[model samples]
Target: MAHHRTFDLLSRLPKVDLHLHLDGSVKPETLLELALHQGIDLPVYDREGLIPHMRVGEECGSLIEYLSKFHFTTRIMQSGEALERIAYEVVQQSAEHNCKYVEVRFAPQLHRNNGLTVEETIHHVVEGMKRGQRDFGVRGGVIAICMRNHSCQSNLEVIEAAAQFVGKGVVAVDLAGDEAAYPPEFFREVFAESTRLGIPVTIHAGEAAGAVNVYEAVTNLGAVRIGHGVRLKENRSILEMVKERRIPLEMCPISNIQTKAVSSWEAYPIREYLEQGLLVTINTDNPSVSGTDITNEYRVLSDRFGFTAPELVKLIMNGVDAAFLDEADKLLLRREMENEISSLGVSL
Candidate 1:
């Protein structure tokens, strides 16, 4: 396909993003503005410093260093008002990128440094999402994230807060943050509780860790989706299980390359996972942090992995199917996305 044609087609294709972090999506300009307003000093305040950190370059040598960039963004988002504004901006940015629906995840515990209770943190983000939906006509849901390194009790508390907001825009629970330090087995009870409440669960596994993390997430934590599950390719048994179970892997190629999860886009296991019949969906895990969007991700896949228009469409459908929303909403969004793709004259 011609590059411009592919770009145009991808831009017009209605899509759903299943994996995106709220704090990680803060735009550099927005971060600078927020920092100035709050009088917070950051090393990378100028465009020169900010641009390098935003892109998937030498700055992100490892997942830990990649995450350190968020410290600058999250430092300014200490209040409920800041969280709400950033959430609204996240949804608005998604809509601008032609996303029809998005599941935005965030670790609320990280926001409590300003003495804001967990409930209050959820309230701020949920309110922002609601406002964005009402204003931009893009449907969204919040996934409450529990950091892995935290104690099991802390994870349970986050899950309890998520349970409280079940029908109120908080649709799911997730395990994230520093995969190497904490394993998925540590949060078995939390995942069980989330499953018992009928809330969907996903875990950040196989990104910085090994395939064992992915296996534990599925068998031990009951994860329906695996975040950055590129490592699952190393273990055939786990790969087979993921394929048989039809678990979705939210593959963020740019973020993976930036965080050293994989060497390059061509080396990414997204094609391997797709060929093995594991439901794989493309996403920009953190657009601002990775200096990418859905369009850029699609372009990278198409260019490096030789994904055709139909293949990209299938990826979008996979995301819609794997979303945490209700069946009725999924059916509705699927139909709408298909219609949009059809309008682009792309054969699927």
Candidate 2:
């Protein structure tokens, strides 16, 4: 059995985060400051107005409504300076949470409404991320996300932009957005292009949709990692396929509950996935919106599901193994984690 204090200490352990959204993790205070700098009036400024919108309560009826809150966030991230600042702040915050490595994803198409070219959009974010790494001493990378609802041709352009940034900090390509209407098959060509270029792919599936989406994402879209694959619980066969293939599921418990994918933390399928031998990695899809962090997510799993320290170490190892980093980097990170755990005198 894992001691509670050990679990609390594990929360402080440096781990790799494989599924965090750079835009979604914006700090509320930073958002307010950015809004003020841009002279934009946001309805929720302080913690009082922000807490209600952040928590998972009766007010958030569905995933769609919960996601609608991004409108306020996107409003302030219109300029190059704003994007750079937010990106830096995101990496800094991740480091504060003891995240040694992170691959932050964001849809460049969403930032184009403010007159920034797609290439320039990626450039600004990459610049910010590089700066964050230099200043914070936390290594980070960018995953370009194409919105699912957009046209396939538009997504190809996003992929092309990402391809151009290859070897320049853009590590992977992902498909994200409303999953209900836009099926995974719609962007097969874009994913094919990513595969052809040897770029890894992750798709948002089994969240708003069901197991069918997960199947299509793997079979048709070539998603090596499935984002928010909570709906895998709906189909046993698909879950087996995931386990057999060793495909990673980036599970976000608080985000799922906030989006009504699950009713509460106790109802989450994380333990089930772990017990079944599926490659599961914990994440905070949107820390600000979900009002949680990597530590809080780990704490919830510990308190609610009785996850032992060894089990928690397995979960962290899963993330480090499943990350998009190169072989050398992965080996270094693995050794670092092992050394830290060994120093703590916790036997696995």
Tell me the tens digit of each residue's lDDT in model 2 across 1-348: 446676558667777788888778887778878888889887677856765554445457788887787777888888888888888988898888888888888888888877998888888888888899998877888999998778888888889899989889898999988888888888888899998888889999998888989999998888999998998989999989988989999998778877877776766888889999999999989887777888888887887888887898899999998988889998998888788778777664
Estimate TM-scores for all models.
0.95, 0.94
Number of colliding residue pairs in each model: 0, 0
- Those runs of model 1 whose alpha carbons end farther than 4 Å from true positions after fitting are 44-49, 53-59
Cα displacement (angstroms), candidate 2, residue 87, comes to 1.0
- Output the number of the TM-score-best candidate: 1
**Model 1 C-alpha lDDT per residue in residues 97-116, reported as the tens digit of each score:** 89999889998888988799
User: Positional deviation of 126 in candidate 2, in angstroms?
Assistant: 1.5
Question: How many collisions between residues are there in candidate 2?
Answer: 0
Q: What's model 2's TM-score?
A: 0.94
